[model samples]
Target: MTEPAGETPIFERIGGAATVDRLVDRFYDRMDSLPEASGIRAMHAPDLGPVREVLKRYLGEWLGGPPLYSAERGHPRLRQRHLHIPIGAAERDAWLLCMQGALEETVADPQLRAGIYDAMARLADWMRNIPEDGRDQAAP
Candidate 1:
């Protein structure tokens, strides 16, 4: 939260929106190619354009940059937004794996990376929506 004087925000340390976009792009690209991500990848729309943009904005706001996502989408009810998806343990782990790989590739600051990873883990857990049957039939 509070950085020493002259220190940058974590958002800036991670290279801000452009860097975040590249990270998200690489993340989706990995999801498309990795066999481990096949199940979760199938849940995404074929076109990743919109998803990429949404993620960029969301990360920008989340990382202490401009409130781009909230400005456009209002409060980010992340749980509500993801409730329709079947995010069981497997799906959650796969998603975190992709994001971790991408963050390692993009963010150089160790502290920033750890902070982001911790937050992502919490958010991913909060997004879980799968029933005991592991089926995703809830409406978004």
Candidate 2:
């Protein structure tokens, strides 16, 4: 919420739209390759085209950049949108793995990257809908 002097926003500090795009690209790339991410990946379509752009726009606004996502899609309602997906601890951790890996490669600032990781981990956890009680997960 409060950025230090000359720090600008997280969005701007990370090079704005271009950086977000690259991060998203790397995130999906990791998901495509990471075995642990297979469950989360199965939640998506065979192609990542539509979700890719949506994530870019969503991250753009989420990091305090332009309101591209809100303008186009109204409120993000992240948890509501993701409730349909079975995002228990494992799924959340897998998602974070891809994102944290992507951030490591894309963001040069270690502190900033850590901050993003911390925030995103919490958000991802909050997206959990199904209980993680060894119950059978719903089909994606």
Pick by TM-score: which candidate is best? Answer: 2
- What tens digits encode model 2's per-residue C-alpha lDDT throughout 44-85? 999999999999999988888889999999999877787667
Q: Count the backbone clashes (under 3 Å) in each candidate.
A: 0, 0
Tens digits of per-residue lDDT for model 1, 2-79:
446777767787788889888899899989988999999999999989998998898887877888999999999888
Global CA lDDT computed for model 1: 0.84
In terms of lDDT, the poorest run of 10 residues in model 1 is 131-140
Give each model's whole-structure lDDT.
Answer: 0.84, 0.87
Where does the lowest 10-residue lDDT sum fall in candidate 2? 131-140
Superposition-based RMSD of candidate 1 using all C-alpha atoms, in angstroms: 4.1
Candidate 1 global TM-score:
0.86
Off by over 4 Å in 2: 1-7, 133-140
